[model samples]
Target: MTTQTPPVLALDVGGTKLAAGILTADDMLQQRAEVPTLAQEGSAEAILGRLIGLARDVIAAAPERPRAVGVASAGQIDPRQGDVVFATDNLPGWTGLALGRRLAEALDLPVFVENDVNAFALAEAQLGAGRGYHHQVLLAVGTGVGGGIVVDGKLYSGSMGRGGEIGHVCIVPGGRPCTCGQIGCLESYAGMRVMLPASGYPSLRALADDYLAGKSIPAVDEAAHWLGHGLAQAAHVLGPEVLLVGGSIGLLGERFLADVRLSYAVAAIKSYRNIPIVPTQLGADSGLLGAGVYARQRSGD
Candidate 1:
């Protein structure tokens, strides 16, 4: 009798980049490739065509043919129907896209679509920062802020599939507006887009440079404050055992981490006095890894 091969293939479709990889059961990538995402094409067909090209490249380099594919994209997805139901700020033409079915048809393999932040959280829970914890919260602060929750090692996508939207959590009641049409969302202030301007930088790497120059401390402090306020509210609701921070803002290191914790303590109710906050071990690749793992699990391989 012949033994069955393992399932592999993961793609991360981001606003700025598209990453594809072939993974093994051991949580390692067998092949990988990355390219820019030129989202100006303005339609799912165009974007997905580019993604399919990238996938083909990885498939060619893989040691063996992958049995399945998983995609982690920035948006709200209807898992039951495998549809991209809403647009995330990152990708412009993602709303109402039949991403799962389309990909499965094109690749001739099963495909899974998951929210990018949820994929990051799953990476943390199963292989990274939250590996040992059954319940954890992942906060991704980058071009925009996103969040994910893992309960008992399983992703809780909530009703409406927008439950982990921690970035949209109102902190200041009537402050800055978010792309999600909400005011006072934490993303309006703490996200990389917000911090870059405050730090007098034209880009994220420049902001990091400004921080190293010692002039961006105030900007960092401001980010931490907004993030803490939002997290305090999250603590009240999800109450995860650990809070794992990822994305561009997390690169701020110890200085911002301290302020985030301090502000959270003040904003949080008494019940969340001791929840641990830490950085994600999977870092930038968390989303990709999580997508692969989710696909493999769903495939039962």
Candidate 2:
């Protein structure tokens, strides 16, 4: 008989896509799958049904049935209570959802729910860019500029999972509209959805190529300016030893980090400029991997 625990099922839900995988006790991803979120789909229940079905398919792909499940969702999730307090239009009708209990009942196994960005931070802190650092901060600039904070090598979600929401920080102060119904948030200024088009670039890769070739794109530079300011502000409060940038627009935080550093030097206090900002090692799969590890740990397995 094998003493090793059965693999855990990990699900990562984002505005653009949904991904699922089976993670072994050793942190190996055994089976994985993906699908478009198509958030236009009328209701949260309807979308969740699709994800549940997709999760089932991936779970079966593995040799053994997973004993637990962990979900990383893009919203204001209360991990301690296993519910969603609020969500942006990114995931319509996601507010006040009892995702943890619902999934536990449906899957017949223990379930853990986490904010997607927090999950990313946890994964990076353990296995990626933030490794070897006592404190780390992760800024995921995908559809929006989501952030996660790790303090003293541990995930830091404030009392109600509201600790590391760096995306909503008001950098522009009425400059751009945010999905959170706020004006001039970091998301408004740096989110790829708004920043990419504003800069006249079709994609982050295109922007990266142009910037790497020593060309100046208004949109990219503008984003860096805001991001640097945001980072500087975060540095004062969080005091992390290392900072990581990730998500689709990151492109290894290549040209972006350089520009950010330039701005950060001007905005942050003299001493705070010493913080090292780097690219995330786990680009797209941080949430998936983190969900698995988090579930296993929280479940006491």
Candidate 3:
């Protein structure tokens, strides 16, 4: 008789929200719950308390006790130590937090942490749009832009676990200032923080609504163009088999993706222009699922 593997608990910590779920032995996410992060409060303890509460809420609904916990967070993470090496102001007071150790102590379970975008890429590569592809890249365009890379069916987090930071890629030399204290980065142009204001809309949903309703928003087009340029640069460097676009902005649907593709065609070399680019299949749950899967793997469960 074979013993069953226990489910894994997963949490995703973003600047805007905190989410928790259970990845069942059958590989489905269950007992999902989320709440606004309210990061502007600038209290790491408060945020962590909320995360722990959310995790417990989900665990109460799980069919079986989870074997471990996995966290996906928005920052440059030291996966070995489960520490946040750096974070933008979006997640104030997040840097230097010993997230993994704290969570392990709080939950009394083994805990693993990874950059949220890297976790998203892991899910996409193993179970979502990047499935069946050994080499792929994922760009998540939302309040900020982030990226993850998978090589030979494994996530390739670079030295210090900051490899797939595609958002910081320079698309324009000395252009707009970015939140990361850099100039001319792809995120400065394509991220929602810039695009929303440039579009003269109060919110990203409003801008997306107008664009999807056939209103030709120049700001949207411009952001897409820059995003394409960033992708072109990635193509030139990594030459991945597929490119996956996720995050709220990336979900603006086919029309926006067409615009990005057009700009990519203009920027990429002829030989690299034909690589397939697609949207992420896992949608909002990618980070949660990825975190769970990563924990399961790391824990040898």
Candidate 4:
């Protein structure tokens, strides 16, 4: 007789929100709960307490108790130690946090932690858009742009787990300043924080809506163009089989993707120009699901 694997708890901590869910052995998510992060309003400890409370709420609604916990967080995470190596002001007081150890102790469960974008890439490669591909690149363009690289069907987290920081790649030398203390980085031009204000749209969704309605929004177009330029550079260095675009802005659908493709074609070398760029299949759940899957795989469960 075969024994069924137990469900695992998945947590995603972003600058704007905290989420928790129960992921079954079969990869289905249940009892999902979310709360605003309000990162700037309180100390990290208070935010952690809120996350812990969210986790407990989900666990209470789950059909079975989870055996382990996995966290996908916005930061440069040390996968080995499950701590934050670095973080931008988006997640205030997040750097150098011993996240895994704290969660493990609080819930009395083994825990694993990974950068949120890396987790998103893992989920896409394993079960979403990049499925069946051995190598791929994923770019997440939301509040801030981030990236993840998957080589040989596994996440290539680079030295100290800081690889795949494509958003920090310099696209325009001596241009706009970025949050990472760099000038002309892709995020400075393409991220929502910049695009939304520049486009005079109250939100990314509104900008996308206008673009989709045949309204020409110069800011959105400019962001897409720069994003494509960044992708082309990434492609030249890491010739992946495919590129997956995720996050809120990326999901602007075919119209925005067409613009990015046009820019990519112009910027990329001829040999690398044919690579397919597609939307992520899992939508908003990629990070949460990926964290759960990573925990299960790493724990040998």
Candidate 3 structure lDDT: 0.90
User: Candidate order by TM-score, highest to lowest?
Assistant: 4, 3, 1, 2
Local accuracy of candidate 4 as per-residue lDDT tens digits, 220-242: 89998999999999999999999
Taking all chains together, each candidate's TM-score versus the true structure is 0.91, 0.89, 0.92, 0.93
lDDT of each: 0.83, 0.84, 0.90, 0.90
Q: Which parts of model 3 are misplaced by more than 4 Å? A: 1-3, 35-41
lDDT of 2 by residue, 258-286 (tens): 88889989999999889998888876788
**Residue 51 local lDDT, model 1:** 91
RMSD of each: 2.4, 2.5, 2.0, 1.9
Give the lDDT of residue 91 in candidate 1.
80
User: What is candidate 4's local distance difference test score?
Assistant: 0.90
Determine which window of 10 residues in candidate 3 has minimal summed lDDT.
203-212
lDDT (Cα, tens digit) per residue for candidate 1, span 234-291: 8889888999888877667776788899999999988796999888888778878999
lDDT string for model 3 (1-301, tens) is 7777999999999889999999987888888899999998989889999999898888888879899998999889999879999987778888999999999988888999999999999999888999899999999998889999999877789888978889999899979998889899999999998988888999877777888899999989999999999999998999999999999986579999998999999999999989998999898889999998788878885
Error of 3 at 118 (Å): 1.2
Clashing pairs in 1: none
TM-score (C-alpha, index-matched) for candidate 1: 0.91
In model 4, the worst 10-residue window by lDDT is 203-212
**Better by TM-score, candidate 2 or 1:** 1
